[model samples]
Structure formats: C-alpha cells, structure tokens
Target: MAFEQPLDRTAPSISEAIDHERGRQESTLGMIASENHVSESVLEAQGSVLTNKYAEGYPGGRYYGGCQHVDTVEELAIEHAKDLFGMDHANVQPHSGTQANMGVYFSVLEPGDRILSLSLSHGGHLSHGHDVNFSGQLYDVEQYEVDPETGYIDYDAVASHALEVDPDIVVSGSSAYPREFDYERINEIADDVDAYHLADIAHVTGLIAAGVHASPAEHADFVTGSTHKTIRAGRGGFIMCDTEHADDIDSAIFPGAQGGPLMHNVAGKAVGFAEAQTSEFESYAEQVVANATRLAERFTERGLALVSGGTDKHLLLVDLRDSHPGLTGKQAEAALNDVGIIVNKNTVPGETRSPMVTSGIRVGTPALTTRSFEEAEMGIVADLIVDVLDTPDDDAVHDRVTSTVDDLCEEFPIYE
Candidate 1:
C-alpha cells in the first residue's frame, strides 16, 4: 500500500519542487561523496505527526509540557545511538554536524582558546575551524595538513604541531582525504598535551557503525557525527562523551547550542539506528566500501590520479590536474551534471586553484550502493564518468552517458 494523500492541494509550488527533485533523483546518478539516499521508512518517520510537538529538554526533564510521547521517541534515539556507537552518553540534537561541534566546544573551551584541526582545503570541514565559521572566528585556530607528497595526513607533523600549539582541543576527522586516521596516535598526542581529542566522524559514521572503520569512541574524549551522512538518519547531529561529561554535553546541546529538539527527526534517528543494527545494514555498509574500491580501481586503471592513491572507505578524491589539465573541478562538475552524473568539485592537497574552481572531484559509492548497485554496476558507471570527462563537450558522449544513467536509475529505483 502507498500513502495516496496528495501534497498539491496544500502547497502547489512546494509540492511541485518536491516532485521535480524526486524525478531528478530518479533519473540522475548521485555520486556526491557527502550524500546518500535515505530509506522510505526513515523518510516516513521524519514526516510523522511527531513533528508537531515541542520537546525542549532531555528525556524526562522537559522545559515544556506534552512531551511524554516525544520523550519516548528521543529516549529510543539516545539509547539506540549509545548502543550503535558504544558510547556512555548520546545527545541526538544539535541540528547539524556544525552545531554538534559547537556543543562540544561550549562544553569544554572558552572563546579565544587555541584549536588544532585539519585544514578545510586539505579535507577538514568548516565547523572544525574555517575562518568564516564561528569555530575559527571565536577561537584561536591552527591547522594540520596532508603530506603534500603522499596526500595523507602527516601524523608526525600533526603531533609536532599539537605539542607546539598546545591547543585546548585537537580535532580529528575530515570531509575529504581518502585514507584512515590513526586515532590512537592522535589520542596519545592529545594526552601528552593534556588536551581533549574531539573526533568528528561526520563522514565515517556508517563505516564505524559497521566496524569497517575504527571507532573513535575509545580514543577521543569527544565524538560527533552527522546522522544523515553515512548513517542515513535524519538531517541532525550527535555528540557522544563519557558519563563523566554527559550532563555537560546535554546542557551544552540544549541551552547552549539548540532549543527544542526536532522530535520528528529524533523519531527518524531512532528508526534509522534500529535499521543500522541489523545484519542487512552491516552487509549494505560493507558493500558500499566494496563498490568504492571497485570504482577506485577502475579510475586507476583508466590513469586518473586519486588522492592517497585510493580509498579505504566509502569515498575517494580524484585529483584531475594530472589527468585533465585544462578541465578544472568546476568544469568537470558542470559537465557531469549536464550528463546526469552528479559530483562535487573538491580541492586536493597543495591546491593552488580557488576553492570555487578547484582541481579535483570527490566521488563516493554510498548513494549508488544504497540503490542496490553492485561492483559490476559501479564499474560501468565509473567508465561512463571517465567517458564524460574525456569528452565533456562532445554532444554524442553526453547523450550516451545520459541514456546509461537513466537506465541505471530506472533499474535501481529509490522510493517508487
């Protein structure tokens, strides 16, 4: 059975845009490394009547009335999160990954405090300490970068800098960078400096959930993630800390960063977390990585230069400077978008180009794999991606690529 209730009667333009976006997804390839398609169940929970409630405080300690049922939803989300990540405490609010980081900082640091994190251009996220963001604006921020040669995090360099800067919190985790971080090593440096290690696993939440990527729960003093990314939950953020700092985290999240929690999204988180606990989700996560590996191998075989040479998780960064000299990341992005294969322009390490017009493209497999695409399908898609880039302006190549993308999207329908 389907929900036959119509949206046009209530909101024509909004409903039209929603329908158009759905049709867009149904036709194009979603290759953006930071994106994924959520399950219909998750979508339903997010769209539930729970959205009409007010839940201002934690489970029982409510700042508002009529929160009993919403309390249950939030408790389930928190407990499921604790179990999923093996943490002593979980705050399922914060609105987004940046807000989650904000909560952590509020719990620990004062303004003007020193913060050490990866550079945004070198795979770090804005919330970590980009100057335009509050993290950089309020705090004294410094950054560590990938080894310009290997395109990997320079561990020794980070340790040396951490020791010298003695930052209040050393944040680890990134939006790009294809390799893994030695959390234990970073943990040691944080300990030596008597600083807290805030591991923002916003990108690898699903991999960590599936045990494919190492969990930072044991190593970092604070761990934050986006529920939407690899986790495929609602668009929200979370923070996990030990019980010793649980109250601080909860306080920082509520009165500090956000007001009433989005109960519907909290319900959605509970649903997604339950889904993640199953064996099927574990298999799905593993397959996501496998598909990425296949795509990386294909790209390598086709002579494209990959950041860190390849991927160990669900995403990879392709540096196009060597493979396609004149074609900037912006150009490649526009060309791929025209042909129905969606991807984002990214900046590689030692990038000289402007952020808006970078020299690389970041691609991932989580979305396609969620569409039930296997290694074989990934190979074909990878070939098509290379084909578009090889002849971006050729009308015939664009037509062929668009046709193949449509066929694949039809074969692996998302929400129909």
Candidate 2:
C-alpha cells in the first residue's frame, strides 16, 4: 500500500514539522529509557485503514457492525501477546500503560482500599500510587523506598512496610530501576499478607519476551505493559492475567475505563509480537543489555557515580553530585539536548532536589541498540557526554560533538 505524497502546493504545513522532527530524531542519540524506534512493519500497520473502525467490544461481541476484519486483527494481537508473555489471557485495548494499570485497580480494589507500592522518586511510576494520580486519589496509598546506602530496593524493608500497612494490593515494578526485580519475593510477601500482586512490566516487557529479563507473567496475579516502550510497537497498552481473573480484567478495561479499542495499533502490536518471537529479536534484546552494560562501564571509568553502583538492565541513573556537584539534572539534560543527545532528568535515591531539578539523569541504550549501535559506540557516546559535562560553556566542543553525532546518525540511518 503506497501512501500518496502531497504535492508542494496542496501539502499541509505539518509535513515540514513532521519531517523536522524526524530529522532531529535521526541526527540525535535517543537515551530515554522508555523510548525505542519501531520497525517499518509496525509503522505500516499503525497507518493502515483499520484505524477507521469503531469496534466497541471484544471479538464476536462488538457493539458496532462491520467489525469482522478488526475482530480478527484484535484476536491475533491477543493471541500473539499471550504467546509472547506466556500468560493465560491478554487484553490489548488500553491507550497507555497507566490506563492498563487503572483497569487492573478497578478490577479488584475498591475506592479507599489500601495499596502499597514503590515511591516514584525511588523508581516507581506515577500510576503506581503517586499522589497526583487517580491511583493515590482513589486508593489509600503507602509507599516503600529503596535503601539509601545501596540505592537498591530492599525486600526486607518492603516486606516490613507491607506488613505494617497491610495493603489490599501490592504493586511491584518501576520506571527507572536498574537492577533485576524479585517477583517471587514480592509474591511471597503479598501472599503472606493475603493481598493481590500486580506487576507493571511496561519498561521490561520486551526483555521478558526475549528471555533477557525475568518473567512476571507466571507469578503475578496481574501484569500490565505498554507496547511502545521496549516492545517497539506502535503506541498502545495491554494487560495479562491468570485465566481466573480474565473476565474481571476484560470487564474493567472495556466497560470500566476505555471504550472501543484502536484496531490499527492492535494490529501493529500483533506484528511486534510476531517479530519478538523470532531468534533475531532475541539477539537484539541481548545487545540492548550489552550496550547498556558497556555504557555503565564507560560512565564509571569516566568517574561518574551510578545509582545502585551499577545497572543490571537497559538503563542506568547517574548521580551527578560527585562529578558536577552544583549542576542539577535539569542543567545536564538541557546541555545534552543542545548537543543532540536526548535524556531525561530524574531524581536519585534520597534526592534533596525537586523533581523539576533532579539530582541525576536517566540514560538507556534501547533506541541506540535499535539503531544497531554496539558496545564500542557506547564508550564513545559516554566520552562525549563526559566532555560536554566537563566543559558546559564551550560552544566549540558542543558544535564539534553535534557534527560528530550527525555523522554517526547518518551511518545508522533510521527508518530507511
């Protein structure tokens, strides 16, 4: 299917804007932990005519007519997701991971029920009971923190907190955690308290699918994820659970939170899942981790302090206090962005600064890995970062780095 290219006279001005954005992405280093470049197949599916459908219900039970093709697409998406994660059931309808989490909360917990989760500054997500979100507003929220010294989650402390709070549900997972999670331990704690366990593996779903990360599908009562993160699918979300809770999850997602599903994104997700099932995807997943480890090692060699001392996953949080004492994460982020390397400012464990001006920066290798960058390039990228940080006021250095970045990106050539 060929998309019509707009003639110069009739073209929307947004065409330039889209092209500009794409050019920027192509020329820069994308180190955001939650971002990845999707394959052309996924993009093709996302732009397909399936977006015109209004399939308001599940397969064979739609509220609208003319859903036969959409029904097949959605069913294929669900089946592929189930096979990808080894789950008994799948629901690929939520517009985002937060919505998937909302559905899970609605499925089991009542308003004002106690819920225990990790603190956002300590690597938890906003939907995991942050005060500004509905999860905290509607439910009684108690948060656990990582150890101050080790900068890692302390299960003993988490268990103690859970026992004290006696939460109705225990949520485990994170947005920026660098180490492996102990799902079995979390499950045991939840079992001891007779509480439900919900694991939001949005960031690590691709790794889990590729057997690079531990699988929570077998242990957690409920699992939620975003398809776009490491999965490299189009924008969408999904939920999986034990077959016993399948009906409740379906009801919660459909009638409780969202209406009709985006069949186009679902189709894209199906394609991503099928791709993930291949051996090539496994190699990509392994390289993602390898690149991340190499980056972490480079940071250490350059005298940058890493949170939790190092990373065991695709992302690492750098504590800037040691290398650039007075420079906030906000400043470092801006400086990197100026030189075409993108990353987000984030709070380190026990941070004294505000979220807007955090103490650390979160960096990842997924997008770079997706562009086929290897461990050697990771070291060079780290050196560039160190040099930029060391000479923030030098435009010559920034200009030179930006030129080099453009050349490197040209070699990688994303979306060709």
Residues 55-116, model 1: lDDT tens digits: 88888899889888998898899999999999999999889999999999999999999899
Model 2 lDDT tens row, 114-155: 889989999999999988999989999999988989988999
Off by over 4 Å in 1: 1-6
Residue pairs of candidate 2 with colliding backbone atoms = none
* Candidate 2 overall lDDT versus native: 0.91
Q: Which consecutive 10 residues in model 2 have the weakest lDDT in total?
A: 1-10
lDDT of 1 at 106: 95
**Candidate 1 residue-wise lDDT at 179:** 81
TM-score of each: 0.98, 0.97
